[model samples]
Target: MEFSPRTAIVTGSDSGIGRATAVALAEAGMDVGITWHSDRAGAEHTAEQVRAAGRKAAIRQLDTTVIPGCAAVIDELAEELGGLDVFVNNAGAGDGVGFLELDHTIWARTMDINLNGAFACIQAAARRMVAAGNGGRIIAVTSVHETQPKVHAAAYVSAKHGLGGLIKTIALELAPHGITANSVAPGAISTPMSGQDGDDPEPTLYPGIPLGRSGRATEIAAVIAFLALPASSYVTGASWAADGGMLQMGPVGSAHLDSSNWRQG
Candidate 1:
Protein backbone atom coordinates (compact mmCIF):
# COMPACT_ATOMS: atom_id res chain seq x y z
CA MET A 1 0.00 0.00 0.00
CA GLU A 2 2.71 2.48 -0.94
CA PHE A 3 0.09 4.80 -2.34
CA SER A 4 -2.65 4.20 0.19
CA PRO A 5 -5.26 6.96 0.36
CA ARG A 6 -3.76 8.33 -2.85
CA THR A 7 -5.79 8.67 -6.04
CA ALA A 8 -4.78 7.40 -9.49
CA ILE A 9 -6.37 7.88 -12.88
CA VAL A 10 -5.63 5.17 -15.43
CA THR A 11 -6.60 5.70 -19.04
CA GLY A 12 -7.97 2.81 -21.15
CA SER A 13 -8.76 0.86 -18.01
CA ASP A 14 -11.41 -1.34 -19.61
CA SER A 15 -8.95 -4.09 -20.59
CA GLY A 16 -5.41 -5.16 -21.28
CA ILE A 17 -2.53 -3.56 -19.44
CA GLY A 18 -4.69 -0.67 -18.29
CA ARG A 19 -7.16 -2.96 -16.52
CA ALA A 20 -4.38 -4.93 -14.96
CA THR A 21 -2.72 -1.73 -13.78
CA ALA A 22 -5.93 -0.48 -12.19
CA VAL A 23 -6.31 -3.75 -10.29
CA ALA A 24 -2.66 -3.69 -9.24
CA LEU A 25 -2.98 -0.17 -7.86
CA ALA A 26 -6.21 -0.99 -6.08
CA GLU A 27 -4.60 -4.03 -4.50
CA ALA A 28 -1.94 -1.66 -3.19
CA GLY A 29 -4.69 0.43 -1.55
CA MET A 30 -5.01 3.39 -3.91
CA ASP A 31 -8.34 4.79 -5.05
CA VAL A 32 -8.49 4.27 -8.80
CA GLY A 33 -10.39 6.14 -11.49
CA ILE A 34 -10.85 3.88 -14.49
CA THR A 35 -11.49 5.30 -17.96
CA TRP A 36 -12.46 3.49 -21.12
CA HIS A 37 -12.71 4.87 -24.62
CA SER A 38 -15.09 2.19 -25.95
CA ASP A 39 -15.41 -0.61 -23.42
CA ARG A 40 -17.95 0.35 -20.76
CA ALA A 41 -18.52 -3.27 -19.79
CA GLY A 42 -14.83 -3.89 -19.23
CA ALA A 43 -14.60 -0.69 -17.22
CA GLU A 44 -17.41 -1.85 -14.93
CA HIS A 45 -15.71 -5.18 -14.51
CA THR A 46 -12.50 -3.47 -13.47
CA ALA A 47 -14.41 -1.25 -11.07
CA GLU A 48 -15.87 -4.36 -9.45
CA GLN A 49 -12.38 -5.77 -9.02
CA VAL A 50 -11.27 -2.54 -7.43
CA ARG A 51 -14.14 -2.70 -4.98
CA ALA A 52 -13.40 -6.36 -4.29
CA ALA A 53 -9.90 -5.26 -3.34
CA GLY A 54 -11.37 -2.91 -0.74
CA ARG A 55 -10.53 0.26 -2.65
CA LYS A 56 -12.60 3.09 -4.07
CA ALA A 57 -13.14 3.08 -7.82
CA ALA A 58 -14.84 5.28 -10.39
CA ILE A 59 -15.55 4.96 -14.11
CA ARG A 60 -15.51 7.60 -16.81
CA GLN A 61 -15.33 8.06 -20.56
CA LEU A 62 -11.93 9.29 -21.69
CA ASP A 63 -10.60 9.88 -25.21
CA THR A 64 -7.03 11.15 -24.99
CA THR A 65 -7.15 12.01 -28.70
CA VAL A 66 -9.67 14.75 -28.02
CA ILE A 67 -7.69 17.85 -27.11
CA PRO A 68 -8.60 21.12 -25.36
CA GLY A 69 -11.57 19.61 -23.54
CA CYS A 70 -9.27 16.86 -22.29
CA ALA A 71 -7.81 19.46 -19.98
CA ALA A 72 -11.28 20.13 -18.58
CA VAL A 73 -11.83 16.44 -18.10
CA ILE A 74 -8.62 16.22 -16.10
CA ASP A 75 -9.67 19.11 -13.87
CA GLU A 76 -13.09 17.56 -13.30
CA LEU A 77 -11.62 14.15 -12.67
CA ALA A 78 -9.20 15.56 -10.12
CA GLU A 79 -12.17 17.12 -8.36
CA GLU A 80 -13.95 13.80 -8.40
CA LEU A 81 -10.97 12.02 -6.92
CA GLY A 82 -10.79 14.71 -4.25
CA GLY A 83 -7.24 15.50 -5.42
CA LEU A 84 -4.89 13.60 -7.74
CA ASP A 85 -1.57 12.05 -6.72
CA VAL A 86 -0.66 9.85 -9.62
CA PHE A 87 -1.53 9.47 -13.31
CA VAL A 88 -0.90 6.61 -15.73
CA ASN A 89 -1.40 7.44 -19.40
CA ASN A 90 -1.82 3.92 -20.75
CA ALA A 91 -4.15 4.61 -23.70
CA GLY A 92 -2.45 4.31 -27.09
CA ALA A 93 -2.81 2.56 -30.46
CA GLY A 94 -0.61 1.01 -33.11
CA ASP A 95 -0.64 1.79 -36.85
CA GLY A 96 0.90 -0.49 -39.45
CA VAL A 97 1.83 1.20 -42.71
CA GLY A 98 4.87 1.50 -44.92
CA PHE A 99 6.26 5.00 -45.13
CA LEU A 100 5.70 5.27 -48.89
CA GLU A 101 2.36 3.49 -48.89
CA LEU A 102 0.95 5.43 -45.92
CA ASP A 103 -1.46 8.26 -46.79
CA HIS A 104 -1.25 11.66 -45.09
CA THR A 105 -4.56 10.99 -43.29
CA ILE A 106 -3.23 7.80 -41.75
CA TRP A 107 0.01 9.45 -40.78
CA ALA A 108 -1.76 12.45 -39.22
CA ARG A 109 -4.25 10.40 -37.24
CA THR A 110 -1.51 8.12 -35.99
CA MET A 111 0.51 11.03 -34.69
CA ASP A 112 -2.54 12.68 -33.14
CA ILE A 113 -3.72 9.62 -31.29
CA ASN A 114 -0.47 8.03 -30.19
CA LEU A 115 1.75 11.00 -29.57
CA ASN A 116 -0.33 14.17 -29.32
CA GLY A 117 -3.00 12.63 -27.17
CA ALA A 118 -0.42 11.41 -24.68
CA PHE A 119 1.29 14.77 -24.72
CA ALA A 120 -2.00 16.45 -23.83
CA CYS A 121 -2.72 14.03 -21.03
CA ILE A 122 0.70 14.58 -19.49
CA GLN A 123 0.33 18.30 -19.71
CA ALA A 124 -3.07 18.22 -18.01
CA ALA A 125 -1.90 15.90 -15.27
CA ALA A 126 1.24 17.90 -14.62
CA ARG A 127 -0.80 21.08 -14.34
CA ARG A 128 -2.87 19.57 -11.56
CA MET A 129 0.18 18.25 -9.74
CA VAL A 130 1.95 21.58 -9.94
CA ALA A 131 -1.09 23.30 -8.53
CA ALA A 132 -1.30 20.86 -5.66
CA GLY A 133 2.31 21.71 -4.69
CA ASN A 134 3.10 18.11 -3.78
CA GLY A 135 5.22 15.44 -5.37
CA GLY A 136 3.46 13.13 -7.85
CA ARG A 137 4.10 10.40 -10.40
CA ILE A 138 3.41 10.48 -14.16
CA ILE A 139 3.90 7.39 -16.27
CA ALA A 140 3.46 6.75 -20.00
CA VAL A 141 3.05 3.30 -21.53
CA THR A 142 5.15 3.30 -24.67
CA SER A 143 6.28 0.45 -26.94
CA VAL A 144 9.58 -1.23 -27.80
CA HIS A 145 9.50 1.14 -30.74
CA GLU A 146 10.63 3.58 -28.12
CA THR A 147 14.15 2.60 -29.17
CA GLN A 148 13.75 -0.05 -31.89
CA PRO A 149 12.01 0.47 -35.23
CA LYS A 150 9.67 -1.87 -37.09
CA VAL A 151 9.94 -1.73 -40.89
CA HIS A 152 6.24 -1.54 -41.91
CA ALA A 153 5.15 0.28 -38.77
CA ALA A 154 6.28 3.74 -39.81
CA ALA A 155 3.64 5.75 -38.03
CA TYR A 156 3.68 3.69 -34.88
CA VAL A 157 7.43 3.60 -34.66
CA SER A 158 7.74 7.30 -35.33
CA ALA A 159 5.10 8.21 -32.75
CA LYS A 160 6.53 5.93 -30.09
CA HIS A 161 10.04 7.22 -30.61
CA GLY A 162 8.69 10.74 -30.33
CA LEU A 163 6.71 9.93 -27.18
CA GLY A 164 9.78 8.51 -25.48
CA GLY A 165 11.77 11.61 -26.32
CA LEU A 166 8.87 13.71 -25.08
CA ILE A 167 9.00 11.92 -21.74
CA LYS A 168 12.65 12.82 -21.30
CA THR A 169 11.92 16.43 -22.14
CA ILE A 170 8.94 16.61 -19.78
CA ALA A 171 11.00 15.07 -17.01
CA LEU A 172 13.51 17.90 -17.21
CA GLU A 173 10.71 20.45 -17.03
CA LEU A 174 8.77 18.76 -14.23
CA ALA A 175 11.62 17.72 -11.98
CA PRO A 176 11.74 21.13 -10.34
CA HIS A 177 8.16 20.64 -9.21
CA GLY A 178 8.97 17.40 -7.39
CA ILE A 179 7.03 15.45 -10.04
CA THR A 180 8.66 12.50 -11.79
CA ALA A 181 7.93 11.48 -15.38
CA ASN A 182 8.91 8.17 -16.93
CA SER A 183 7.87 5.68 -19.62
CA VAL A 184 7.51 1.91 -19.63
CA ALA A 185 8.41 0.58 -23.05
CA PRO A 186 6.93 -2.87 -23.54
CA GLY A 187 8.19 -4.96 -26.42
CA ALA A 188 5.77 -7.60 -27.80
CA ILE A 189 2.97 -7.64 -25.30
CA SER A 190 0.20 -10.14 -26.08
CA THR A 191 -2.73 -7.78 -26.14
CA PRO A 192 -5.74 -7.48 -28.46
CA MET A 193 -3.48 -5.31 -30.63
CA SER A 194 -1.14 -8.19 -31.41
CA GLY A 195 -3.15 -11.41 -30.83
CA GLN A 196 -5.70 -10.59 -33.55
CA ASP A 197 -5.34 -12.83 -36.60
CA GLY A 198 -7.57 -10.93 -39.00
CA ASP A 199 -6.25 -9.53 -42.29
CA ASP A 200 -6.01 -6.15 -40.63
CA PRO A 201 -3.39 -7.45 -38.20
CA GLU A 202 -0.34 -9.53 -38.91
CA PRO A 203 -0.56 -12.22 -36.22
CA THR A 204 2.77 -13.85 -36.97
CA LEU A 205 4.51 -10.52 -36.97
CA TYR A 206 7.83 -10.26 -35.07
CA PRO A 207 8.21 -14.02 -34.68
CA GLY A 208 11.89 -13.17 -34.92
CA ILE A 209 11.61 -11.51 -31.51
CA PRO A 210 14.30 -13.28 -29.51
CA LEU A 211 11.97 -13.49 -26.55
CA GLY A 212 10.43 -16.45 -28.44
CA ARG A 213 6.98 -15.44 -27.20
CA SER A 214 4.70 -12.47 -26.69
CA GLY A 215 4.23 -11.05 -23.18
CA ARG A 216 1.00 -10.97 -21.21
CA ALA A 217 -0.77 -7.71 -20.33
CA THR A 218 -0.39 -8.25 -16.60
CA GLU A 219 3.35 -8.56 -17.03
CA ILE A 220 3.55 -5.04 -18.38
CA ALA A 221 1.14 -3.74 -15.73
CA ALA A 222 3.43 -4.92 -12.95
CA VAL A 223 6.27 -2.82 -14.36
CA ILE A 224 4.06 0.28 -14.43
CA ALA A 225 2.99 -0.38 -10.86
CA PHE A 226 6.63 -0.38 -9.78
CA LEU A 227 7.22 3.06 -11.22
CA ALA A 228 4.07 4.40 -9.54
CA LEU A 229 5.32 3.29 -6.14
CA PRO A 230 6.86 5.69 -3.62
CA ALA A 231 10.06 3.66 -3.47
CA SER A 232 10.88 4.82 -7.03
CA SER A 233 11.17 8.47 -6.00
CA TYR A 234 14.75 8.92 -7.19
CA VAL A 235 13.92 7.64 -10.69
CA THR A 236 12.91 10.13 -13.36
CA GLY A 237 13.38 10.52 -17.10
CA ALA A 238 14.19 6.82 -17.39
CA SER A 239 12.54 4.27 -19.68
CA TRP A 240 12.48 0.71 -18.35
CA ALA A 241 12.13 -1.79 -21.20
CA ALA A 242 9.75 -4.67 -20.37
CA ASP A 243 10.43 -6.68 -23.53
CA GLY A 244 11.73 -10.01 -22.20
CA GLY A 245 15.27 -9.25 -23.38
CA MET A 246 14.15 -8.99 -27.01
CA LEU A 247 15.54 -5.50 -27.44
CA GLN A 248 19.01 -6.82 -26.74
CA MET A 249 18.83 -8.98 -29.87
CA GLY A 250 20.94 -7.33 -32.53
CA PRO A 251 20.55 -7.94 -36.25
CA VAL A 252 23.74 -9.96 -36.48
CA GLY A 253 22.51 -12.15 -33.59
CA SER A 254 23.39 -11.49 -29.95
CA ALA A 255 26.35 -9.19 -29.20
CA HIS A 256 27.92 -12.40 -27.92
CA LEU A 257 27.76 -13.74 -31.49
CA ASP A 258 30.26 -13.12 -34.29
CA SER A 259 29.38 -9.67 -35.64
CA SER A 260 32.78 -9.74 -37.40
CA ASN A 261 30.94 -10.94 -40.51
CA TRP A 262 28.90 -7.67 -40.66
CA ARG A 263 29.60 -4.05 -41.50
CA GLN A 264 29.28 -1.29 -38.93
CA GLY A 265 26.15 0.86 -38.65
Candidate 2:
Protein backbone atom coordinates (compact mmCIF):
# COMPACT_ATOMS: atom_id res chain seq x y z
CA MET A 1 0.00 0.00 0.00
CA GLU A 2 1.18 3.52 -0.69
CA PHE A 3 1.74 5.73 2.38
CA SER A 4 1.03 9.44 2.31
CA PRO A 5 1.65 10.33 5.94
CA ARG A 6 0.03 13.59 7.07
CA THR A 7 0.35 13.25 10.84
CA ALA A 8 2.91 11.74 13.23
CA ILE A 9 3.31 11.39 17.00
CA VAL A 10 6.75 11.14 18.56
CA THR A 11 6.98 10.53 22.31
CA GLY A 12 9.87 12.21 24.15
CA SER A 13 10.12 14.88 21.52
CA ASP A 14 11.31 17.43 24.05
CA SER A 15 14.85 17.12 22.75
CA GLY A 16 17.51 14.95 21.18
CA ILE A 17 16.58 12.29 18.63
CA GLY A 18 12.86 12.68 19.26
CA ARG A 19 12.96 16.42 18.62
CA ALA A 20 14.87 15.92 15.42
CA THR A 21 12.41 13.30 14.22
CA ALA A 22 9.39 15.53 14.92
CA VAL A 23 10.95 18.26 12.81
CA ALA A 24 11.89 15.84 10.04
CA LEU A 25 8.36 14.48 9.81
CA ALA A 26 6.97 17.99 9.75
CA GLU A 27 9.40 18.90 6.98
CA ALA A 28 8.12 15.87 5.09
CA GLY A 29 4.69 17.49 5.11
CA MET A 30 3.17 15.91 8.20
CA ASP A 31 1.59 17.54 11.22
CA VAL A 32 3.37 16.44 14.41
CA GLY A 33 2.27 15.73 17.98
CA ILE A 34 5.19 16.30 20.34
CA THR A 35 5.39 15.03 23.93
CA TRP A 36 7.74 15.76 26.78
CA HIS A 37 8.44 13.93 30.01
CA SER A 38 9.73 16.79 32.14
CA ASP A 39 10.48 19.66 29.81
CA ARG A 40 7.30 21.32 28.55
CA ALA A 41 9.37 24.29 27.47
CA GLY A 42 11.63 22.07 25.41
CA ALA A 43 8.65 20.36 23.82
CA GLU A 44 7.19 23.76 22.96
CA HIS A 45 10.49 24.60 21.34
CA THR A 46 10.24 21.49 19.21
CA ALA A 47 6.68 22.44 18.34
CA GLU A 48 7.90 25.85 17.26
CA GLN A 49 10.32 24.21 14.85
CA VAL A 50 7.55 22.05 13.43
CA ARG A 51 5.37 25.10 12.92
CA ALA A 52 8.31 26.88 11.32
CA ALA A 53 8.40 24.01 8.78
CA GLY A 54 4.82 24.96 7.87
CA ARG A 55 3.09 22.02 9.59
CA LYS A 56 0.62 21.86 12.42
CA ALA A 57 2.17 21.03 15.80
CA ALA A 58 0.58 19.72 18.98
CA ILE A 59 2.25 19.45 22.37
CA ARG A 60 1.53 17.24 25.37
CA GLN A 61 3.22 16.08 28.54
CA LEU A 62 3.68 12.32 28.45
CA ASP A 63 5.16 10.11 31.10
CA THR A 64 5.52 6.68 29.60
CA THR A 65 6.08 5.10 32.98
CA VAL A 66 2.43 5.69 33.73
CA ILE A 67 1.51 2.53 31.77
CA PRO A 68 -1.95 1.81 30.22
CA GLY A 69 -3.23 5.19 31.34
CA CYS A 70 -0.28 6.91 29.71
CA ALA A 71 -1.35 5.36 26.43
CA ALA A 72 -4.34 7.66 26.33
CA VAL A 73 -2.03 10.45 25.23
CA ILE A 74 -1.61 8.65 21.92
CA ASP A 75 -5.32 8.69 21.30
CA GLU A 76 -5.64 12.31 22.34
CA LEU A 77 -2.83 13.34 20.02
CA ALA A 78 -4.17 11.28 17.15
CA GLU A 79 -7.53 12.96 17.56
CA GLU A 80 -5.94 16.39 17.72
CA LEU A 81 -3.78 15.73 14.67
CA GLY A 82 -6.87 14.54 12.69
CA GLY A 83 -5.21 11.08 12.38
CA LEU A 84 -2.04 9.21 13.06
CA ASP A 85 0.19 7.79 10.34
CA VAL A 86 3.42 7.39 12.25
CA PHE A 87 4.18 6.57 15.89
CA VAL A 88 7.72 6.77 17.23
CA ASN A 89 8.48 5.39 20.72
CA ASN A 90 11.54 7.35 21.68
CA ALA A 91 10.89 7.76 25.39
CA GLY A 92 13.20 5.56 27.51
CA ALA A 93 15.61 5.60 30.42
CA GLY A 94 18.84 3.91 31.56
CA ASP A 95 21.22 3.67 34.46
CA GLY A 96 24.76 2.48 35.18
CA VAL A 97 23.94 -0.01 37.94
CA GLY A 98 25.59 -3.36 37.37
CA PHE A 99 23.83 -6.70 37.67
CA LEU A 100 24.95 -7.38 41.24
CA GLU A 101 23.92 -3.96 42.41
CA LEU A 102 20.66 -3.88 40.50
CA ASP A 103 17.57 -3.73 42.70
CA HIS A 104 13.91 -4.49 42.03
CA THR A 105 12.82 -0.85 42.08
CA ILE A 106 15.39 0.20 39.54
CA TRP A 107 14.70 -2.85 37.42
CA ALA A 108 10.95 -2.35 37.44
CA ARG A 109 11.25 1.37 36.75
CA THR A 110 13.51 0.72 33.82
CA MET A 111 11.20 -1.91 32.44
CA ASP A 112 8.14 0.27 33.00
CA ILE A 113 9.67 3.20 31.17
CA ASN A 114 11.39 1.41 28.31
CA LEU A 115 9.53 -1.84 27.67
CA ASN A 116 6.12 -1.86 29.32
CA GLY A 117 5.32 1.71 28.44
CA ALA A 118 6.41 1.17 24.86
CA PHE A 119 4.08 -1.82 24.59
CA ALA A 120 1.09 0.17 25.76
CA CYS A 121 1.77 3.19 23.57
CA ILE A 122 2.53 1.14 20.47
CA GLN A 123 -0.57 -0.97 20.97
CA ALA A 124 -2.72 2.12 21.33
CA ALA A 125 -1.30 3.55 18.14
CA ALA A 126 -1.74 0.30 16.26
CA ARG A 127 -5.35 0.03 17.37
CA ARG A 128 -6.02 3.52 16.07
CA MET A 129 -4.39 2.73 12.75
CA VAL A 130 -6.35 -0.50 12.41
CA ALA A 131 -9.61 1.21 13.28
CA ALA A 132 -8.91 4.00 10.81
CA GLY A 133 -8.18 1.38 8.15
CA ASN A 134 -5.05 3.29 7.20
CA GLY A 135 -1.66 1.62 7.03
CA GLY A 136 0.83 3.16 9.44
CA ARG A 137 4.42 3.08 10.61
CA ILE A 138 5.68 2.25 14.13
CA ILE A 139 9.26 2.98 15.05
CA ALA A 140 11.07 2.49 18.35
CA VAL A 141 14.31 4.20 19.22
CA THR A 142 16.21 1.42 20.96
CA SER A 143 19.92 1.34 21.72
CA VAL A 144 22.76 -0.72 20.28
CA HIS A 145 22.45 -2.53 23.58
CA GLU A 146 19.29 -3.99 22.14
CA THR A 147 21.55 -6.37 20.22
CA GLN A 148 24.62 -6.36 22.44
CA PRO A 149 25.30 -6.49 26.16
CA LYS A 150 26.90 -3.55 27.88
CA VAL A 151 28.73 -3.32 31.20
CA HIS A 152 26.91 -1.61 34.09
CA ALA A 153 23.60 -1.57 32.25
CA ALA A 154 21.93 -4.91 32.79
CA ALA A 155 18.41 -3.50 33.14
CA TYR A 156 18.85 -1.18 30.18
CA VAL A 157 20.13 -3.97 27.99
CA SER A 158 17.30 -6.23 29.02
CA ALA A 159 14.66 -3.57 28.38
CA LYS A 160 16.03 -2.74 24.96
CA HIS A 161 16.24 -6.42 24.05
CA GLY A 162 12.64 -6.91 25.12
CA LEU A 163 11.48 -3.85 23.19
CA GLY A 164 13.28 -5.05 20.07
CA GLY A 165 11.62 -8.46 20.32
CA LEU A 166 8.26 -6.81 20.85
CA ILE A 167 8.66 -4.88 17.58
CA LYS A 168 9.42 -8.08 15.69
CA THR A 169 6.32 -9.77 17.01
CA ILE A 170 4.19 -6.72 16.29
CA ALA A 171 5.47 -6.74 12.73
CA LEU A 172 4.18 -10.28 12.27
CA GLU A 173 0.80 -9.63 13.85
CA LEU A 174 0.23 -6.25 12.20
CA ALA A 175 1.46 -7.08 8.72
CA PRO A 176 -2.02 -7.95 7.52
CA HIS A 177 -3.24 -4.63 8.87
CA GLY A 178 -0.76 -2.82 6.64
CA ILE A 179 1.18 -1.48 9.60
CA THR A 180 4.97 -1.87 9.74
CA ALA A 181 6.89 -2.14 13.02
CA ASN A 182 10.62 -1.55 13.25
CA SER A 183 13.30 -0.51 15.71
CA VAL A 184 16.18 1.90 15.26
CA ALA A 185 19.09 0.86 17.50
CA PRO A 186 21.44 3.74 17.84
CA GLY A 187 24.98 3.62 19.22
CA ALA A 188 26.58 6.29 21.39
CA ILE A 189 24.99 9.61 20.51
CA SER A 190 25.94 13.08 21.63
CA THR A 191 22.75 13.87 23.48
CA PRO A 192 21.99 15.03 27.00
CA MET A 193 21.65 11.39 27.96
CA SER A 194 25.25 10.89 26.91
CA GLY A 195 26.45 13.96 28.83
CA GLN A 196 27.22 15.83 25.61
CA ASP A 197 24.46 18.44 25.95
CA GLY A 198 23.69 18.29 22.22
CA ASP A 199 27.11 19.33 20.97
CA ASP A 200 28.45 18.56 17.53
CA PRO A 201 29.54 14.92 17.46
CA GLU A 202 32.23 15.41 14.82
CA PRO A 203 35.05 16.53 17.11
CA THR A 204 34.09 14.26 19.98
CA LEU A 205 36.33 11.20 19.73
CA TYR A 206 34.44 8.00 20.36
CA PRO A 207 37.60 5.91 20.39
CA GLY A 208 36.10 2.45 19.96
CA ILE A 209 33.44 3.40 17.45
CA PRO A 210 34.44 2.91 13.83
CA LEU A 211 33.17 6.33 12.83
CA GLY A 212 35.76 7.91 15.16
CA ARG A 213 33.02 10.04 16.73
CA SER A 214 29.60 9.86 18.30
CA GLY A 215 26.53 10.01 16.09
CA ARG A 216 24.49 13.17 15.73
CA ALA A 217 20.82 13.00 16.75
CA THR A 218 19.82 14.20 13.28
CA GLU A 219 21.64 11.26 11.73
CA ILE A 220 19.40 8.82 13.57
CA ALA A 221 16.40 10.98 12.75
CA ALA A 222 17.13 10.60 9.03
CA VAL A 223 17.05 6.82 9.28
CA ILE A 224 13.73 7.01 11.14
CA ALA A 225 12.29 9.43 8.59
CA PHE A 226 13.15 6.97 5.83
CA LEU A 227 11.39 4.15 7.64
CA ALA A 228 8.30 6.35 7.99
CA LEU A 229 8.18 6.94 4.24
CA PRO A 230 6.37 4.84 1.65
CA ALA A 231 9.79 3.94 0.30
CA SER A 232 10.17 1.64 3.32
CA SER A 233 6.97 -0.27 2.66
CA TYR A 234 9.05 -3.32 1.92
CA VAL A 235 10.88 -3.06 5.21
CA THR A 236 9.48 -4.27 8.53
CA GLY A 237 10.48 -6.27 11.61
CA ALA A 238 14.02 -5.01 11.00
CA SER A 239 16.25 -3.33 13.59
CA TRP A 240 18.23 -0.65 11.83
CA ALA A 241 21.35 0.31 13.76
CA ALA A 242 22.35 3.93 13.27
CA ASP A 243 25.41 3.24 15.36
CA GLY A 244 28.74 4.05 13.75
CA GLY A 245 29.61 0.36 13.43
CA MET A 246 29.52 -0.05 17.20
CA LEU A 247 27.98 -3.50 17.08
CA GLN A 248 30.61 -4.66 14.62
CA MET A 249 33.32 -3.75 17.09
CA GLY A 250 32.83 -6.68 19.43
CA PRO A 251 35.62 -8.88 18.11
CA VAL A 252 37.72 -5.94 16.99
CA GLY A 253 37.25 -4.21 20.34
CA SER A 254 38.25 -7.31 22.22
CA ALA A 255 41.36 -7.57 20.12
CA HIS A 256 42.34 -4.04 21.01
CA LEU A 257 41.62 -4.22 24.74
CA ASP A 258 45.04 -3.66 26.26
CA SER A 259 44.02 -3.57 29.90
CA SER A 260 41.70 -5.22 32.43
CA ASN A 261 40.09 -1.87 33.22
CA TRP A 262 37.51 -2.48 30.52
CA ARG A 263 35.88 -5.06 32.79
CA GLN A 264 35.79 -2.73 35.78
CA GLY A 265 32.79 -0.93 34.54
RMSD of each: 5.1, 1.2
- Candidate 1: residue 225 Cα off by (Å): 0.9
Could you tell me the TM-score of candidate 1? Answer: 0.87
Error of 1 at 154 (Å): 1.2
Candidate 1 clashing pairs, residues 3+ apart or interchain: none
Every model's TM-score: 0.87, 0.97
What lDDT is reached at residue 248 by model 2?
92
Candidate 2: segments with Cα more than 4 A from true spot: 199-203
Which candidate gets the maximum lDDT versus the true structure?
Answer: 2
- The C-alpha local distance difference test score for the whole of candidate 2 amounts to 0.91
Candidate 1 Cα deviation (angstroms), residue 231: 0.6
| Candidate 2 lDDT, 139-196, residue by residue in tens | 9999999989888899999999999999999999999989999999999888877776
Which 10 consecutive residues of model 2 have the lowest summed lDDT? 195-204
Candidate 1 lowest-lDDT run of ten: 196-205
